[model samples]
Target: MSAWLRRLRPGRRTWLRLGRDAAILLVVYAAVSLWQTRHLASGSAPALAAHAIDGSPVSLDALHGRPVLVMFWGTWCPICRTELSTLQALSRDWAVVTVAMDSGDAAKIRAFMRERHLDFTVIADPQGAMSRRWGVVAVPAGFVIGPAGQIRFRLVGLTSSWGLRARLWLARGGF
Candidate 1:
């Protein structure tokens, strides 16, 4: 073997340590991430029927021809606040509705939305009943529902706007 190749090879001890650290990191990451998403429904969304904060009736069964973004958010959650922009941007091309989990009553949510300049549709989950029904345990959790009423993807963290748009596009068979 070439001297350079021999020099580049790590010693057995170094390799073992590196492998151990990597394995540990992987396990830790999996545990944390699973905690965030393990409770979310995987294939299809649940029967959702409620009134929007604006008093509009919201039923997922009625939105059959367009992809819907079901977002779970809390006013006090920093991650949810930060991810709101992505949701707003995606609202332009898709059906985006957020469930305000424990954010307060309709009046409070209206004021918060006005203050934040968030124009997307919102459903009030003042008691978190809707969120619990949706199987959402984490703030900022997102579920992409296809036009045919199937959940195409589930996002448990701060997902990018482009990632959401791409999922919507693919769900529409835009490929």
Candidate 2:
């Protein structure tokens, strides 16, 4: 074997240390995630029935037969902006309903949606009343509602599209 290759190989002890570190990091990440979502809504989701910015009616109760992704976000939130595409993509395969928490009036939200080319159903919560009922104090909060109308997962902050997809799939399976 070449000297460089031999030098690049990690020893058994090094591998063990790396594994320990990874485990610790995972624990820390999980703890933080739990802490961040401590105040989020749980149990049965709050009643959400409103008109989308596009004039279509939206209601969480109507989507009870299938898992639904309910997201609370704002146009001013950069993290929420980054997740727009993810939410839009998920809407194609699953039911997605978003609350624009204090984003703006219906006209402004409609403009933002047009600019981003997003077709996801968005209900404007200009006064944040809907978000308050959902216990969402932060932007970019997400909930995976099971087919039985229970909240299966509460996610705070940014989350990967695949992670959300997995949660939706799990919810569908009655998890």
Candidate 3:
């Protein structure tokens, strides 16, 4: 074997290594994208419904005159817990609604709320019908709906404080 060839590690060719890494990354990316897109397409607003923690039915009318933050979450999701806390802290100035995808178990949802000490209005969507309506395949998804009933902003994952602030600023109608 040539000295140069002997010097090369068995599988250390740059092009080959890059191609393999790229392929793996592309596959993972495609899978996540496909999952998110499918969930998005399957979910829509107005098709799901839920009752508040107090057993009162929550409707769009409740938010008719206000900008609403729709947060979809579950007790099992760590990110949901972190995001929920962040949201609750910043949401004092805004009307926020939470939908628990726990499916019919008001008890579980309530326990989660109590444990987290979250004070926002929480509705139970035990069947995931509401989740589907909101295109929430992943936990910790959020939607900011304007007073006009249109989606002003949508966040699909763990959001930074800066990002949340930016959205809030935009909602307040700034440049």
Candidate 4:
């Protein structure tokens, strides 16, 4: 083989190595995501009935005819902060009920919401009782509950607005 053809062999090998590395990385990511959400609620969602920080009644059962996004987040979680805007936007068009997992008392959460100009309904889980009940071990956990009250999807960590919107749409029987 000529020198030019011989040099091309290493380039082909490099591409193969890059592809293998990418595949491995993707597998690792899938494994970690699965492990992180292993204990999360599934099938029929747990009963959630509580008063919002504004003293309004918020019940998952009330939203039984439509898909609802139930999010577990915290004021102290930086990643959750980044997702707050996405949640606020989603709340405008969909049912979004967020639990402030160990964030603080109702007053503190209200203040945080006010500072962020966020109007999404928040249920303060100061003692993490709600989080524990939902099997949420970390912040930024999201669950899409279908109209029949079944959990349609569960996501952990930071999720894009489009990603969340798609999940809610899917839960609503949208293709």
Candidate 5:
């Protein structure tokens, strides 16, 4: 009888401890996940000014009542190139803006656009002011802004058509 009691006690204690730990961890994970999701969904669009390939001033004010897709990238990044192609193809129904991050020489940007026959507007952010304002520390970041100047979706790196579609859908007030 004594031996059986000891065996049962140890096993029960072990399982109880494990269950408590797992429950705590799960709660913490759920809270963090909720915070992240909410944080991403609740921001006004970063008010960064735009610039032309020649470094002249440009305004996003025209996009006030329309959806806007802002893509951050560098000419040297292959992922950026792919994203550019995808965006170019999808620009017919959406307003797309591609801002290159310090890829040097505006001519390079013009050349790349012309070579690809991309009709989307391409801007050069040589000073990185716009990049910093957008909280873009990495290349190939994307933001889909709603008509009210709110950022509905944000992509940190290279993304797919499905991702863009989902973002646009969200921007359009869809789930």
Candidate 6:
């Protein structure tokens, strides 16, 4: 031990170990995230022909010539709530449509959205049929589709606004 270090109680190694462990945990989390997204397709996204909460017909097939962000969420999901503001902001610039799964009827969803001040386009999927078709088993799932209707990036869990924006940029053919 160094002479100056010997003057104090000797537990400096424990602090080092804690930092090392935290770093390892972060690495493991990143590895798992990469593994989960490793094989997600860059090919065509699944068909999404449905009705919006406003009783208007909505179809992903019609959006083939533009990039779109498809989000799967529920009002009851906390993580979904966290991403809504980011999504709302993105909608003004990017084409974003969210499927509200298990969020009750149009009236209930409308009330919820009004309370939250969310103005993004929402398609209600109370029966979960459409969500299943998209292979979404969790809330707050997001897919960035390219101009050619190709699935470019998939996001699961609480994705940061910057991250989503970056992927949106990528979908727009930006580096």
Per-residue lDDT tens digits for candidate 4, residues 137-162, read 98899999999999999999999999
For candidate 1, write residues 38-66 as lDDT tens digits: 88887878988889989999899888898
Candidate 6, residues 1-175, lDDT tens digits: the string is 8888876754889789989999999999988877665544447898898888888888988888778999999999998988889999999988899999988888889889999998888999898888887777777888999888889888778988788888988888887
lDDT tens digits, residue span 47-131, model 3:
3345788787777666675666777888777888778777787668777788888645887777877887877778887887778
- State candidate 3's TM-score: 0.69
- Candidate 3: regions farther than 4 A off: 1-49
lDDT per model vs. reference: 0.87, 0.95, 0.72, 0.95, 0.76, 0.85
Q: Candidate 2: where are CA atoms >4 Å away? A: 1-7
Clashes in model 6: which pairs?
none
Please give each candidate's TM-score: 0.80, 0.92, 0.69, 0.88, 0.70, 0.80
Clashing pairs in 1: none
On TM-score, the stronger of 1 and 5 is 1
Best by TM-score: 2
Off by over 4 Å in 5: 1-42, 54-57
Residue-level lDDT of model 2, residues 79-149, one tens digit each, is 99999999999999999999999999999999999999999999999999999988899989999999999
Q: What is the per-residue lDDT of model 5 for residues 1-175, given as tens digits with 9 covering 90 to 100?
A: 6987888766777999999999999999777645543423248876656677756665667778877888889988888887877888767777887788888767888887788887677788777677777777777878899888888777666678777866877787776
Q: Supply the global lDDT for candidate 2.
A: 0.95
Q: What shift in Å separates residue 96 of candidate 6 from its native position after superposition?
A: 0.2
